[model samples]
Target: MQLKELSGQSGVSAASIKYYLREGLLPAGETVHATRAQYSAKHVERLELIQALRRIVGLNIEQIRGLLKMADDGAPRLTVLAAVQRVVLHLDTAAASGDRPTPAADAVVRLRNWPDYPSDARNALNVHLELMESLHIPVTRELLDTYSKAMDDVAGLDIAVTTAPDSVDQLILTAAVGMHMHSQLLLKLLALAQASHAIRRYEEDA
Candidate 1:
């Protein structure tokens, strides 16, 4: 497919596609002539991914660039997916807020030292905290703790599944589908497990 064909199929303007090509978000197409280039299905898929990351996921160009680099380098799709998930979640929540919120000094301090959280993740979290504050949602220490614990539990399970050698593809597929289709159930199951463990601990203490 030519640039115009790709543009037509992707719903992205030809100029924007060229811009993405220049920015290294999309791979260079095959040089057919001095002025003509031919794109393939891979290019089309990548362009759609870029568009989705930008327009739907609300990632800035630089952030999308980082993600594209990671994807191109054959980094585990889980890592990219996790980062994208965090960004999309924050974007959706923030979009619902009419006003920006201020981050608590303590929350900022805690977030600053959070290990393995890239700058983009921190930015997204900051935006989410601000949105919560604007909505009068308390940025209490307990709230942060709860969020951290929930993420930790999910990440632990995800890591376990992804590391399993025998069914890696199946695991990734399950995660991709389950995270979208059964997210509520997954959350509920985690909450139930936590509640059960808490009850057991209380009973033992009593």
Candidate 2:
């Protein structure tokens, strides 16, 4: 199809498509003649990914470009996936700082019998623990375990949806979009559950 058809199919304007072509966010199509290019289904797919990153995940142009590069880089699968996860999580590139939450967080992770998490993952937990401590909130093992069990269910769903896809870019895009949107799913689920339970427990007074 031509650029006009591509734009119509993808619901993107022609000028924005041209801008993406120039920005390296979208790859150029096959040159059919001196002034015309022929796009294919792949181009439409790429445009959908680009629009989701922008409209759904709220990633800017540079982040989307970088994410595309990371997904397409010929690194080993696990390495590329780790890179994508870090990008989606917005974790720092540097190694963990080994701050106050490391040991306790490490203990909880070990107790959960999960793999030895990377320092960055541990540190994300640690930072929150530190904040809770500063606010005098009790960080109990039972609470940690409860939250871990709930998140294990979520992580299982993440793997089910993101890992089975053959396209690495699709995997990355699914993870990015799912994590951003489904967090709200969890939040709203909690709110609804609480409301239902509270309604059930309400006692009518005489």
Candidate 3:
């Protein structure tokens, strides 16, 4: 496909595509002539993934480049997925900002036995603790234990689906894009369940 066709098919502007090509975010299309170039299905797929990472996952060009490199280099899927998650979920910034994990966070990690798991999970828990502190919300160990139980329940499905993808690239995309999307869906369902419970409890009083 030509640049115009690629742009149309990918739903990204030709100008942006050219910019990505120049920035090394997208691979260069095959040059057919001095000016003309041809793109393939791979380009289209790559563009779609790039767009998702940019618009949906909110990854900057550098992070996307790293993600693409990790995908192409056949790095360990779990590590690559963790790197992608850190970028997409802003975990790296959170981990960097905090000097150390809060005692509450560390206790939760020990209670949950996540020390053997990937660092991403532990880091995210620390970020949550930081948020609680910043908001002046006192979280009890008991409450954290309850939350951990719920998180573990959700994480079981999250890990299962995220690891099911056959390719490293797909897993990265899934962890970055798909998992957050699914998280939102689950939150919405939880909200609906809460609403239903509230209505059931309050309906008799009304």
Candidate 4:
């Protein structure tokens, strides 16, 4: 495919594609002439991944660059996956500063008994707990337990989806897109559930 065809197929503009090529985000296609080049399915796939990272996953160019480097580094599949998860999670150690929510959060984790869970996930929970505290919201054990159970279900579903038998590229693509989609799905589901409950509780006898 030519540049125009590549752009059409990738849904990226030719100008943007050229910019990605220049920025090393997308590798150059085969040279057919001094000014003409031929792109292949590989180019299309790479462009999709780049687009997914940039538009869906909300990564900056530098973050995408670093992630691409990790993907191409010949690391073990699971190791590469961990890096991808960290990126998707936007894990920030700095956000977890001050009094750690470890003891409280770890109590929930231990209750859930989720083995092999990353510590950064714990940190993320602590960050949220800290925020809730700052807002002067009560952080009850019962609330943590209920939320942990719900999150465990969500995390299980996500793990099942991402760990399905698929190519590395497919798994990476899913990780980039799935999390955002799942968040939206949860919001919609909550709205529907709330509406149903309201109708049941408030609607008059018909």
Residues 41-128 of candidate 3 have per-residue lDDT tens digits of 8888888888888888777889899889888877887678788777766677665545455788777778788654537656676777
lDDT, candidate 1, 99-194, per-residue tens: 332355346446544464344444556666776667998778776777676766776776575445433233333343344434567778879999
Point out the higher-scoring one by TM-score: 2 or 3.
2
- Model 3, which residues run further than 4 Å from truth? 95-99, 117-121, 130-138, 200-206
Q: State the weakest 10-residue window (summed lDDT) of model 1.
A: 92-101
- Model 4 scores what on Cα lDDT? 0.78
Model 4 regions lying over 4 Å from their true place: 87-89, 93-101, 116-118, 134-136, 194-206
Residue 104, candidate 1: alpha-carbon lDDT:
54
Candidate 2 lDDT by residue in tens digits, 1-206: 99999999999999999999999888899999999999998888888888998998787888889877766565666666665556566655433553445556876777778887565556667776776777999888888888888888898888788777787667767877887778778899999999888877884421
RMSD of each: 9.8, 2.9, 3.1, 3.3
**Pairs clashing in candidate 3?**
none
Q: How do all the candidates rank in terms of lDDT, highest first?
A: 3, 4, 2, 1
Q: Report lDDT per candidate.
A: 0.64, 0.78, 0.81, 0.78
Model 1 clash tally? 0
Better of 2 and 3 by lDDT: 3
Q: Estimate each model's TM-score.
A: 0.47, 0.85, 0.77, 0.79
Q: 111, model 4: CA deviation in Å?
A: 1.2
Q: Largest lDDT belongs to which candidate?
A: 3
Report the lDDT tens digits of candidate 4 across residue range 123-173: 677787777778998877888788789988997899788767455666678
